[model samples]
Target: MAVVNEGALKKMLKQYKYKDLTVREITNVISQYKDLKPVMDAYVFNDGSSRDLMSLTGTVPVSYRGGLENCL
Candidate 1:
């Protein structure tokens, strides 16, 4: 799982709040920081169907204590 620096992320978001940021632009910001870089992984369903969470939808799940709590 990728660890994010909340303060840094919030500051960056505030800096770009006035602009219409694209996914790529946001991704670039995240990628620029090591802790904020997203980890690519696949999500598999009970039926054996799987989808790459990163590529399928530029969002990644946030896990805490071995449990998923949210998506980012």
Candidate 2:
């Protein structure tokens, strides 16, 4: 895992934009945010394609048409 400073992590969370983050990248950020566990565990994907940037900050995504809307 690449070592990222707290500032970088915080900035990512603050201005969340959809990006292709690897599983390790997601885990690194989640390790810093305790409340993000549910979001982390509830979703799974290859290529981290289903990850929602907002969910990293504990923001739950609203379902659209009875399905979770993935950022990708």
- Taking all chains together, the TM-score of candidate 2 against the true structure is 0.26
Where is model 1 more than 4 Å wrong at Cα?
A: 1-34, 55-72
Q: Write the per-residue lDDT of candidate 1 for residues 12-70, one digit (tens) a residue.
A: 44434432343444456555433345333667999999864432234445678999654
TM-scores of the candidates in the order shown: 0.28, 0.26
Candidates in order: C-alpha RMSD to true structure: 12.0, 12.5
Residue pairs with clashing backbones, model 2? none
Model 2 poorest ten-residue lDDT run? 33-42
> TM-score of predicted model 1?
0.28
The Cα error of candidate 1 at residue 43, in Å, is: 1.1
Error of 1 at 3 (Å): 16
What is each predicted model's overall lDDT from 0 to 1? 0.48, 0.48
